[model samples]
Target: MAEFPRTDVFSGPKKTIKTPAWEPGYIRDSKSGKPREIPIIKQLYDVLMKLPRDTEKVFTVPKITLVRYFQKALEGANIQDFRFHDLRHTFASHFIMKTRDLPALQKILGHYSPVMTQRYAHLTNGHIRAEMEILSAVWTPIWTPSEKSVPCEVQKSFVK
Candidate 1:
């Protein structure tokens, strides 16, 4: 297998957004009772850290405010109709292209089934084709001509 060069640098914010002690019960856990961890991007962390802390409110800002902020950011970047959820899609798409480990990717993405990872399988067509080529070489068949066989003589007349 060919080795790929590592790309991309994580050089965003140094700030951290503290989650409130009490969150809505429904959003507390996934179906499997595992807690969901929201990754804090550097830009988002910087913005969040600058905001005044609100002890009274369980959440720092309303969902509408977050959506508006994301929309405005997308508009500024000249990206059309981009939503925050699209970030997850983008991560999955890029990861699939670079890595062949679907199970590990599925776990990282919190997908219940590896089948969910199949959506990105088409992105690694080059890798898949290369794998097929290797397999085809290993499993190639060898054919040889067969020798003619003599017919067996019947001895049924004496028995009758």
Candidate 2:
């Protein structure tokens, strides 16, 4: 299902996209029954601030027009073979990597169940190594022959 952002706001930095479009599609998620509110981070807030509040919508242009320009932007930046949906995926992936918070991402992506948002999870390739690092010091072996031996008191405990 496609969602359109709601421009009407009385106060606060939250924005919502409502699903179940007038056009039909496959069942998305049970959690997607209601609109999802996204908190505005500094980058988004800055862009919103720059946009003219004179209009109701943050974007004055039509969705197609914006997509066309976004394509042009991709071309300018030498980004190839990417669609608007790819951008959403990229954003979701990065957000999950940075936050490691699945529920938060589910809310942001408007997924009713985290299972949908899990599709966006591309944890760092080093995730395993990063976790294994905690055990590195523990397994170092205090008395490896090449390294100094432990103090006599420490060594005696091991010897016993």
Candidate 3:
């Protein structure tokens, strides 16, 4: 009954895990009537591959289970204050840094607005500044007063 397809291609002693089922058709469950796809990841694929063949009940993997796994993995790695969601942040940050493709990143992150995607815009500051410098270099003052029309010698001698 789970909406997301488990892409795990492996099997374990528990043969019930490898069966494929249709992903539930998208539905509108809220007042806004928006449809959403289930979030799938490679880790879920691995876990599903190890499931028993006869498992009939839809298994729910909670966020806490992932958080515990994250904590265990980081226990001796010398990292501090890591959260499971930080993986998403790191993915978004690195993707933006490497590709500089805001629209692609926004789609990957499932954000509806570019404003939400703009959080990663700061990563392109170097490019942004370089562009601004390029624009500034091309722009120049159009007019200057004649030296003879200046009231003071200092003003008259001013270079255009």
Candidate 4:
């Protein structure tokens, strides 16, 4: 297996976000009672790699702060009725559509169960339909192949 670089990010200090005390090792994943390993994308890794050596935390911001920034970007893009959480939804939808790997996506998204990730399955249905249409266009249909005297096993394996 190829080695992948890891970025150690200190999510927050020894404190709770609700009442914020000296509670250690608590991040958003603590709510789910499980630790999650989120993958570092190339662009994020490149940007994070630029942080100074003395930096301990990768990013430290409240949800409201993130929402404020997201809203600004939304205004610039002329997008409406979009929340900060919608970004996560959009990413999940697209990831499922591209990879068609739900289990991997579930892990990436830090869902407790695969069922939690099923909401994105509907989005993938459209992708599957589009892919099937492409297959129909590129290769002849089953009826056409059968009429052309194609072998059943070969047709079932590749053409179908």
Candidate 5:
């Protein structure tokens, strides 16, 4: 599943990671069983452009080797219990929080069903806290009466 995308896949600003129809592997379209095109940002496009393209594939190393390298990087950084697949979860959570668009996220994640994308789109604690803060404006009183002052009618209306 960790197929390093081919250099040929890059078209202009976007780098679409789709399996070819004739030579297919993991990239499966849930609806058409072909492939989906996901757009890559300009930053990523620039970074990928800088890489040396000696081979047809963008990455020179094998898939397994890249996984090993990722694992090594995790160990070096003292990160624990993190997997490559976890990146999808992290991306989904941040994307949803930032964009607040589930449908857009589903398309980006290539989820055939919205349910699958929902599984990944978890709201972080900070994001939830930020959302709750929006309620403050609604609850705020337009005019706060003076605590020390009392109306004359109320004083007169009071029974001994």
Candidate 6:
């Protein structure tokens, strides 16, 4: 994030903004050694748009200061064992849950291999349940209980 250049946040056609990888003073990229363009959500775009563009870099905050601020905020919110990088994981998981598109995520994340993106993929229980509900809608029941038939003991436990 410290290496993010202001010029990288480009506005494309249709008012869309994307952040291209910026690795200033580096030969083979900075973080992951892979550079890619990542589309920014409207909310993030709005926030970034509000930042003062005084320097060539978008964010003037030092890396250590930002880390300390994040740690303080996390502690204030009673969050534990969470690092800044965890936000990437959360974003990846939510993105896959919403779009179900791994290839797109792989490109956005700048992963050279799909396996790296697969490692980031995680499904929430709610998302799994929602998917199961969709499957249940399409499935045909093979055996349904008759009105006169006695419910099984196990089934009785589920009766409301």
In the range 1-160, model 6's lDDT, one tens digit per residue, is 3446333343665454444332333222346545544566666656665677655443568889999999999999999999999999899999999999999999877787999998898998899999999999999975666766576743764573
* TM-score, cand. 6: 0.68
Candidates' TM-scores? 0.44, 0.59, 0.46, 0.59, 0.66, 0.68
Best-to-worst lDDT order: 6, 5, 2, 4, 3, 1
* lDDT for position 39 in model 5: 60
The best candidate by lDDT is 6
When superposed on Cα atoms, how far off is each prediction in RMSD?
15.0, 10.6, 10.7, 10.2, 9.7, 10.1
Specify the poorest-scoring 10-residue window by lDDT in model 6.
20-29
Model 2, residue 125: what's the lDDT?
Answer: 66
Q: Give the worst 10-residue stretch by lDDT in candidate 5.
A: 20-29
RMSD of 4: 10.2
- Please, what is the whole-model Cα lDDT of each candidate in the order they appear? 0.59, 0.65, 0.60, 0.64, 0.72, 0.72
Query: Compared with the true structure, what per-residue lDDT tens digits does model 2 show for residues 52-160?
Result: 5444444578889999999999999998988988877888878876777888888777777888888877666686577578688578675554255557756676786
Alpha-carbon deviation at 41 in model 5, angstroms: 0.4
Q: 1-160 in candidate 4: lDDT tens per residue? A: 2122344555577543232211123223434656555666666666655555432344556668878888999999999998877777888888888888999898877876899898744585678789989888889654433445657665676744
Pairing residues by index, what is the TM-score of model 2?
A: 0.59
TM-score: which is higher, 3 or 6? 6
Cα-based RMSD of candidate 6: 10.1
Q: What shift in Å separates residue 126 of candidate 3 from its native position after superposition?
A: 9.7
lDDT tens readout by residue for model 3, 55-106: 4333445558867877988987978887766777777877777787998888
